[model samples]
Target chain A: MSFLAAASTNINPGLKAMGYGLSAIGPGIGVGIVFGQGVNAIARQPELTSTIRTNMLLGFAFSEALALIGLVAPFIYTS
Target chain B: MSFLAAASTNINPGLKAMGYGLSAIGPGIGVGIVFGQGVNAIARQPELTSTIRTNMLLGFAFSEALALIGLVAPFIYTS
Candidate 1:
């Protein structure tokens, strides 16, 4: 019983870390979609490239923030 | 001691959720900025509107992904 309990306890942190890693998946996919679309738009309208680029960067920044949260979650929870 | 420990553990989830929620703010603002600039670009150069719109949408999707990640973070952590 004691050994089982110890093993489970050790597994818990790994599970939690895996969760955090998995949580990042959504943001990763989303950001890619956003950029892909942004590029498509720019390609269609070369004249407005500057504006498109600016917006794309801004959106990219935001999407990246979510991953940052995922990275921080485990520390916050365990602490 | 047990009560304090339980209370802290209970509070931990909330904190994690809040962190996730806070993480979304960046993406929200980022997407808005992206759309705003995209619109402005389209307005300035009507001929390239189609291209600009497409790019904008793509960027928007990516930015929104971040929020999705935030939404999933809590569930992943707790599970």
Candidate 2:
């Protein structure tokens, strides 16, 4: 039991950054999808490229907001 | 053993934010998927732009709601 306790003790509890990292993953993927699909749409209809780009930027902003929120959540929830 | 205990005591048990972070991921990706597809659909049929945009916004709201819930979850689950 002492050995187990000693091993566990070595683990750090500064996992707030880990939480931010985890939250960033989803938004990262989300932003990627928005741009990827936007590019595909532009390619299919070059005339609509501007419109597709506008939509992609809007989507990126919305999705990226979540990751930013994650960054702030730890500070907000001190418990 | 005393040294080990002392070291462990310095570590925090604040993993609530981590749970919220994990929960945000799915919805973030969901919102991305909705917008990505919506843009692609609009490219295919520009005439349906309004309809697609409406659907996309609605879907985004639904998906984003999940992330918002995650933000509040840490407070609700204090254990």
Candidate 3:
């Protein structure tokens, strides 16, 4: 692990970026599942499609926000 | 944000931890939606409650696993 550290007693830029990259993966899959299931719910109830669609968008936005945050995290904390 | 740190730093642990923290948010909400909507599905059709409940648990488990991976990421790439 130290081999990747690159500098003694200091932080690493590449490692920080890699961390953000790792972070995006979970939220990416998570958003997919949320929307996919929401759509399935709507499909099962066409009459309730509007309600389901509203909630689906809400869930999707929330899930996507996490990924967006991950995208920005490295810039926020890296020094 | 860079103003919070001194000049010429090699890397930042804060960035990596923040990255992982951001990653967990999506899956957290995702699992919540999976079960929440699943419960609604069961309510709509009581006869299928058992089947819906089983699938709900399975989806929740998978979403939780993603958050778990994000939780471990900072430790993995901290080098």
Candidate 3 residues lying further than 4 Å off, grouped into runs, are A1-11, B1-9, B14-79
Model 3 Cα lDDT, one tens digit per residue, B1-79: 2324324554456566555765576575676577547635844774685787678667766876675576556666644
- Pitting candidate 1 against candidate 2, the one with the higher TM-score is 2
Give candidate 2's whole-model lDDT.
0.83
Model 3, position B77, has a per-residue lDDT of 64
Question: What TM-score does each model's chain B reach against the true chain B?
Answer: 0.79, 0.79, 0.74
Pairs with steric clashes in candidate 1: A34-B58, A34-B62, A37-B58, A41-B55
lDDT of each: 0.60, 0.83, 0.61
Q: B4 in model 1: Cα distance from truth in Å?
A: 12
- Highest lDDT: which candidate? 2
Q: Which is the better candidate, 2 or 3, if ranked by lDDT?
A: 2
Say which prediction, candidate 1 or candidate 3, comes out ahead on DockQ.
3
TM-score of chain B of 2: 0.79
Q: What is the TM-score of chain A alone in each candidate?
A: 0.78, 0.80, 0.73
- Model 3 residue B35 CA deviation (Å) reads 6.9
- Model 2: runs farther than 4 Å from truth? A1-13, B1-13
Determine which window of 10 residues in candidate 3 chain B has minimal summed lDDT.
B1-10
Which candidate gets the maximum DockQ versus the true structure? 2
- What's the lDDT for residue B18 in model 2? 79
